[model samples]
Target: MTRFAQAVAESTRSVPVPRRPDTGRTRVTWRQRLGRDRVLVLVALPGIASLVLFHYLPLLGNVIAFKDYVPYIGILESEWVGLANFAVIVNGDPLFLNALGNTVIITLLQVLVVFPAPIALALLLNSLMSERIKRVVQSVLYLPHFLSWVIVVAIFQYMLGDAGLLNNFMRDYDLGTVSIIGNPEAFKALVTGQVLWKDAGWATILFLAALARIDNTLYEASAVDGAGRARQLWHVTLPGLRSLIILLLILRLGDSLSVGFEQIVLQRETYGADAAEVLDTYVYYNGILAGEWGSSAAVGMVKGLVGLLLVLGANKLAHRFGERGIYQS
Candidate 1:
């Protein structure tokens, strides 16, 4: 016991003590940090400039919502109308109500069907044993995302219009022509289908990335335990993707009101306003085309406020469910 205590004392004496860090050290100034990271700051300037020019600057235009904005007159000279422009919404104008209803229907369809389509595609692609076949399928699916709305609409019209490919084939077989393109009854379904075709594959990129991040050991361990593919997927794969899915869902809710202005507007005339009109197109036709700028701006402001509320509510719900959501808040 005496020798052991002597040995311990010797070892303790030989070891050096760690010095305390200086809590009183001067803090690094912003200018010093900027100088140290000058190269990175230079690299980020273009993106910062773009945000200021395209995003921040345009927020000033929302002021037009409260003004009787006439492009001929300067903003300073335009008459301030306050909430007068919002009277259409309060009074329940038929055109505005129709646009709102159509927007809601389309948004619901997209959330129910289009949102999950990419995840399903990603799972199927991941299950493929052959890499070449998987790449070919992915390439084919992703091709439509590169096509413009004009080309997408044109392609759909060529394939499904009254006198187009389907109708032509049916005519030869003595089958009656089906009205798809200019049919108001099928317009919502048609547009939703078009959105799915154009974007589903591109959206799959996120799920595929999330899948790639999942550890292979989990699958291997599950296999060793005699767990089937279904069990492994349920236990391992979905848990890995849950966070990303939640994040995307929150973001989707934020932009739920915006359902593609250019795409819907192109078909609105053919299907009539009742079928294809959405909040975005409503704002464009009334504000820019018809020169009801204040009212249009008011509608836009309302849409933005609603989307903001949705994001905040969703983020709070995510917090309650023990998820990070889009931000800490």
Candidate 2:
């Protein structure tokens, strides 16, 4: 602040501003409010109905975790088995444990690598002087996001498969080819890479929006104070993005357990269960394929509970750091 501005602020600190007289604001009734917002309500009815139908209504099926839920017997007719279904988790079944381990490993890898990819890309994009170039690059980067998981997996298989581009090129040059697709050790990394390739560009949208919202004057002020580009980014850009970063981190933690059902399952047979199995596939194989409905329900319920705990824990951590994470305290 300038000297005059500082003096003005200091003077205002001692001045007690007169309070406005209380004019009671008339309270609007629920019906009146509803009438005023009827158009908005109408517009929102489909989304509300969809949420109730798909998200909330399916919650009732968690009861299957406490029952010997046979599809033929139907949900209502299923025998009460109480905690029997959860024994798979409590007793630590070998397959379940393996799936859980794989899940943790993939989630951690994503947190380390996949999560920061968009932020880095956004920064790089923001540094570009040409708007045309930025738009073209962004379009190319996110084009893959619109492609289905099937297409993505197929593209990777074609490029990284045993007889694919890498091996073909290596053969022409007499260089040894490294196995990537269907390799047990590389499956986790492969999954993370695929996620980064597909979603990173799409994710950059929010960060770019956040960057646009930052005050241009802050950058000007930092420059006036002799701050270089890197210093301005560190001091001005990152601080502006901190809250959004925290909010995204909290959300990502909540859904961390689900690596990719369709993506992983497509390659699971080739990689084998030990290499590629995740919680989603575990539930699918046991429930739909093997008809262990109750056990699958138990596992799924546990997944959701764990996710809830992660969100709550991360939100609290954000609060401690004084950032509004996902919600207000």
**Top TM-score: which candidate number?**
2
Candidate 2 Cα deviation (angstroms), residue 51: 0.7
Summarize candidate 1's per-residue lDDT along 129-171 as a digit string, tens digits: 9999999999999999999999999999999998799999999
lDDT of 1: 0.94
lDDT for each candidate structure: 0.94, 0.94
Deviation (Å) of 250 in candidate 1: 0.6
User: Model 1: what TM-score?
Assistant: 0.90
Worst 10 residues of 2 by lDDT: 16-25
TM, every model = 0.90, 0.92
Q: Taking the tens digit of each residue's C-alpha lDDT, what string does model 2 give over 1-329?
A: 99999999999987855554585565667898999999999999999999999999999999999999988879999999999999999999999999999999999999999899999999999999999999999999989999999999999999999899989999899998989987999999999999999999999999999999999999999999999999999999999999999999999888988998999999999899998999999999989899999999999999999999999999999999988888887
